[model samples]
Target: MAKLGIPAAPPRGRRIQETITQLRQRILAGEWPVGSRIPTEPQLVEALGVGRNTVREAVRALAHAGVLECRQGSGTYVISTDELAPVVARRLTDDRMAEVIEVRRAFEVEAARLAARRRTPADLAALDDALAAREAAWRGGRVAEFVEADAALHTAVVAAAHNGMLAELYASIGAAMRRTVTQAMGGALTPDRHVDHARLVAAIRAGDPDLAAREAAAFLEPDPGA
Candidate 1:
């Protein structure tokens, strides 16, 4: 267990996050029985070699997401699988397009920010390929091909961020939104969309975070008229 009062430090937050993810996976994998008390923060901190704050954050997130429950002073408990499963399943397929879009907006905004900061030559190449495919599909009036390429382009922007969590979350919901976009905005890629996509790529390549973010948001925002 963790020695008390040690300010937990993480040499690498990604490793710490991975530890936390493993812990969560273990819990969900039935390693922790329902109503079973999981290790305390101090114990987890020591075991995982991460800061107490990291463990606390992970625990709090899980609790908030309904995977775990913490009593005021007692301890954290794994919730029943049936209960937790539904919550996780719902998270995976909630079907709330508005909520999903809100989440995507937040993610894409940060992705644009990171892309401006971290994009590499290879990232630019991948983005170029995706965009080129999208443009070709759009010009050919092949709606399905356009949809696939459009999804690839949007996801390429996320990948350009170089944030693993952001990329993963974006991929998860991007898959869902791919369907939605094909259904909703699959018609004409639109002059506005073409302009916005090109501008976003240019802003990212130019390392302009604000411009890229604005373009991404504009791309996603619904036309009040449409």
Candidate 2:
């Protein structure tokens, strides 16, 4: 029996997994936002109290999962927040925009219906802020800003549903949804394709689930211009 000595080290596989979780947590916590390079190898080793190899393995794992991107000369950068984003994007190719819209209809319509039933005052307040921001972004005519704002408002609706799984699933496929919206708008958003979500919001505010679901589904209908 050994005595007066340090405990045995954890298994190498478990250590590597723990390191990966720690790194992912940092990214999710916004310690290093997307496009920002992460701490260097030595810095991470010191910070995580792990060896150089362990830090390297963790970074490599995240890179494989599309959450981190390591350039040839520059440091590694945070690319995506959700681990499933890249996977979803890859599965939903560009040519499948119709399928993408169908997927959106499934999530958004249900989320809207449930939001009408379950949303709280705070959720309604957040939705109002997001909707206003989305409209302002559209009027500003900055395609990228508008895309993000629109996505934010839809995400707010999903959040209001108060179903953790639905919210998480929406977030998982969020990048793909934004990509389709961007493609549909092409280079710019013409007045002809303007989408007014005021009715959708009003239905939710009034606790009209059927109206909210109808409003959500209506927006996803075939619009040659939209």
Candidate 3:
């Protein structure tokens, strides 16, 4: 990570907490856009006039919150600007998969309903493109590609809802959901899942909220027999 040099004064408060707040403000203010690397530890320490440990603690805090991501042998990069990202990131863990699934269902079900009512032609087009990519990947026996497209489709559906907060929440758990999807794909790739996706998209296109919600729920429902 390369530091742009501290552009502001140290925030007035507890050293570490203030440092964290200031860093977060910088990110939110677009000083560092998403995917942009943050300043290195030494640079941060120098800029903030804080100890090395203070800088480390602030970085760790932000990273855990999902605002910053540290890549081994590389540097930290901004993953998101959502203020809720850190909160959601902290709660999303392996042990909480069930809870995560429930939350995802809540968002997706409502998203489907809203999308049926609110989706524009552009939204439908994006959905179609994503579905086509997913189908092609499945046909090609490309698990990774299928997973990526599947994720993109779900994101498109949520985005079609046109709710900023809902979209942010969905984006917050994106990393976890992608990992889960990849792992599931390691098992058998069932044809019905793709069929379900097509059904959901069709319902949305038809502008049937009830049908769209039902299709979305059915797609998300875990197979009891599995």
Candidate 4:
């Protein structure tokens, strides 16, 4: 028998999952931008029309997944837009630098080849700008800035590939890739030993897939002796 004017509650597990989905949708919709504090418990409960426990569990789940951060007395904040990025960051440990290099080489080579085939005039312009900025940054003798510029140059190459999925995958591991570059530099950006991207950009410009791929692979090959 049901009480008058009362609705039966959904199963707790289902309620929690539903709440999580609602929260994620709001996030992906950009209602709650990254670095902005999400609604408090009472607000979430009221807005989501769910129980407090359900909201708590959903928040906990996202926090564990690295999509949300909680600071005492501050509140929960969005740390990342992509859920998988944090997972990749956690897995790409310091000792796996070799594996990181290998992965990067594979990604860069394929991206170069695809960019050669698909790049438009706008893509070439972007690549030129990115390469110029990278060179200037390296020549300026700042290791951190050079690393950022290098990442930007490679990202431009991937964008020229015109493959949405590849771009998304590249973005997911972007932070990890930056860390790999920083560690590989060993606290110095040597002038003579810098990885020149001129040939890679030129090959892409020339529409030579083989040359582009080779150019990409040249800098990223892992030492067999290691």
lDDT accuracy of residue 189 in candidate 4: 84
Question: What stretches of model 3 exceed 4 Å from their correct place?
Answer: 1-65, 68-79, 188-195, 222-226
Evaluate model 1: give its TM-score. 0.55
User: Model 4 clash pairs?
Assistant: none
Q: Write the per-residue lDDT of candidate 2 for residues 1-226, one digit (tens) a residue.
A: 4457967777888899999999989987878855446999999999999999988988998888878766544467666777565676567777777778888999999999999999999989989998999999899998888887888789889878987556655655566787888887887989987889999999999999999999999979866765
List lDDT for all candidates, in order: 0.70, 0.83, 0.79, 0.82
Q: Rank the candidates by lDDT, best first.
A: 2, 4, 3, 1
lDDT, model 1: 0.70
Off by over 4 Å in 4: 1-82
* Cα deviation of 172, candidate 4, in Å: 2.0
Residue-wise lDDT of candidate 4 within 74-98, one digit each (tens)? 4786655676657765777777878
Model 1 Cα displacement at 147 (Å)?
1.2
Best by TM-score: 2
Poorest 10 consecutive residues by lDDT, candidate 4: 164-173
lDDT of 3 at 163: 80
lDDT of 3 at 140: 80
